[model samples]
Target: MTHPSTDTATSALPPLIKGPHERRLGVVALVATLGGLLFGYDTGVINGALLPMTQELGLTSITEGVVTSSLLFGAALGAVTIGRLSDAWGRRRTILLLAVLFFVGTINCVSAPSFEVLVIGRVLLGLAVGGASAVVPVFLAELAPYEIRGSLSGRNEVMIVSGQLAAFVVNAIIGNVLGHVDGVWRIMLAVAALPAIALFFGMLRMPESPRWLLSKGRNEDAVRVLSTIRSPERAEAEARDIRATVALEERTTTAGLGEVLRNKWLVRIVVIGIGVAVFQQLTGINSILYYGQVVLAESGFGAQAALIANIAPGIIGVVGAFVALWMMERVNRRTTFITGYALTAICHFLIGFASVSVPTDSAARPYILLILIVAFVGSMQTFLNVATWVLLSEIFPLRIRALGMGISVFCLWVTNALLSLYFPTIIGTFGITGSFFGFAAVNALALVAMIRFLPETRGRTLEAVEEGVTTGAIFTIRSRSRHR
Candidate 1:
């Protein structure tokens, strides 16, 4: 049986028949996404701090890569291990554990006495970042009404970029003021503790996912949880809907990794999911964040100018995310992905050409490249970055949503880690012209993949999307049948 499109599901959200449910859901979503905020701040803060960090830590090029990528590598492990663990333990509880990891990780980084110690601390933070990426969206998606799922899940991306912008602003102030102080980067690193504490404490007031409760055979508890977030009448109805979907999956085969693999269509969609994640990172976006200042400096901006110019991209990223929030619910996912990749590819080429074609000695060259860099940031933020996250959150089957997203993001971070590791060297060898041309090439390929293979996911219910994904039916967008 074919399901209605997401627009139909969204239009069908049980009217705000219950006041308390909506309020509670909003509160819980905000509280849970604190993890996202911390995720953004911790990662973005490093951008401004890396210079002082390198000087104080006495880092070589190899060590610089290690210090930067240790967190990403840790995040890869966190995304995979915690994703599976959350599948069993429960999303809310897993998030709490992640909060603890974030706190400990931040503390370790703040007090590290040596470069090796800092890398360990960063790795710890990576674990928290990875866990947050997987669990928070799962929690949000499970709790949200179908009509608002796009908007609600999209909020996490907003918070993540907001956190990054906050970090960049804070880093600029601290670096400028304490620019002369020893170990000032530690202060920047330590500030992450505030949000970690907030996320941990905030989770105390939140409800366990109603869908998770249903999956574990606690139907009444699911109702209760749903009641806290939806009207009583709608809560009961949604509880039944959720239970039926879970039952369907269970009857098909016990929902597990094995079942997912046994189904050929499920396997195909999973490959697409993994591809989406990898391509998002392969554009070298985070690599820019990880080493933007270095790249900017190499482009002829002085050290202070490079440090300050880094803030421009962070700002653009935040703005682009808000634009994405608006677009996700309105535009076709495939269209947005194609447009985003294509635009970014153009910017990459322009930046590369500007880096080489524009003479370094010419006063306008650095400025032109800077404008191109900002354009690249805008293109990504406005289209690809948040859309990728939104699609990943929405596309997976309920049984493997967290796992699929986790595995996908794991690849993303790993790709990010490798890029972070080798990016400096790549830049060292080919210069900005060569480095950006490589990204352009990757993005050009991604444009084809998106146009040819990616499916539209804008307004479908999770159950509907799951059936489509698991059955390899996404390619066959038949009109909805009256199955229910």
Candidate 2:
């Protein structure tokens, strides 16, 4: 029934870009982001689980801090070590290895009989979390077209906050309905294994990062992998760009910490990365994620009431992430950071004012504090969290991308760990008002840093952006007009 002329014309034309390949890309992103979900759940579960856990484990305040901070300590190490490993072993293989660690770590935590054993399990989980935190964004960034890189890479943060919300919702349900059950906290800790299993299986079918493939001298393989995720024309174009970048790097010295430190431009970028990472933590977002119930209880809510109310911030967190994804596509990264910090600082001041003005026993105090905290979490999720991770993933050149991200995130985890270890003591010594006031001051400084140093990364290819960074054009006033 077909005409020979029609068949020849069709064959001569480029292959029609099908919808299925795009959907496959989405599926790949979703599966890879399950690691983010696990990262959220593992970190946030302890907020509610710790009370029952402490009761069963006979933990003192010091011991409680140990159990809470051990994972963060491990995460710090994991971020650096696993980041370097990813640079060497490839992102897909490292993530597969992390998936295995997630499974083993979850089993260890579920079966832990003593506080020391529990800390060990948490450390293992932290390693997996840290590794995922470092590698997943890079993987997603590499896989995405530069046009949608922010949204694609930022999805990992959404999954992270969603995972946290999942933990909060699960903890509330379990704690309320099964509060009297023996070792109920174990049930909470065990839930992480489900996602771990899903991540392992899902990654088995996923392709290696094409940029990573190109980095290792596998050009044909890189283009072949890219064809699955991108349109044929775009895939070829991207592969050519990546190969050119890799070739340039090969002609120079190898990318590493030593090279990063030796170059002033690279060091400046690394410093900015470190500042972004640290300021994100210094916003005290994790303090809320890890200790929301405690803050609520101190605000005058009963333990049960605090457990239920903690879900409010978690819900807002997920909503804020949605907003962030929208904004990442439309707004400059610098604008997002400034706006987020400004809002969070305002929320902190209001929280402090509400806590100080309202009587400790006043019924209105808890609700007021809760509203402000929700606003703070929303602001943080919207402007800061997703943007920070996305920028960290994008800012560095390919040569030092993994190691730079690792070192920066290593500082982030360390800051988070120190805060987790001391947050309880801080609340005890300063009360909610003084503690929030301190956070306000820190966020004020963060706002200044954002305005002065952070560069816009939207609407540029990874290779183009890296060229700007290496040339220090990104730091100049003229480069703004070019990117704009």
* Per-residue lDDT of model 1, residues 303-324, tens digit only: 8888888889888988888888
**TM per prediction:** 0.95, 0.95
Q: What is the lDDT of residue 14 in candidate 2?
A: 39
Cα lDDT tens digits for candidate 2, 1-484: 2112212322333343666668878888999999999999999999989999999999999999999999899999999999999988999999999999999999998999998899999999999999999999999999987778999999999999999999999999999889999999999989999999999999999999999999999999999998898888768867877787788777764777788778888999999999999999999999899988889999989888999999999999999999999988798888889899999899999999999998987878888889899999999999999999999999998999998899999999999999999999999999999999999999999999988888878866787777768778778743453355
The residue ranges of model 1 lying beyond 4 angstroms of the native Cα positions read: 1-13, 16-18, 478-484
**Best candidate according to TM-score:** 2
lDDT of 2: 0.90
- Please report the TM-score between candidate 2 and the true structure: 0.95
lDDT of 1 at 43: 81
* Candidate 1: clashing pairs of residues: 6-459, 6-460, 21-229, 21-230
Residue pair clashes in candidate 2? none
As a whole number from 0 to 100, the lDDT of residue 453 in candidate 2 is: 87
Top model by lDDT, which number?
2
Worst 10 residues of 2 by lDDT: 1-10
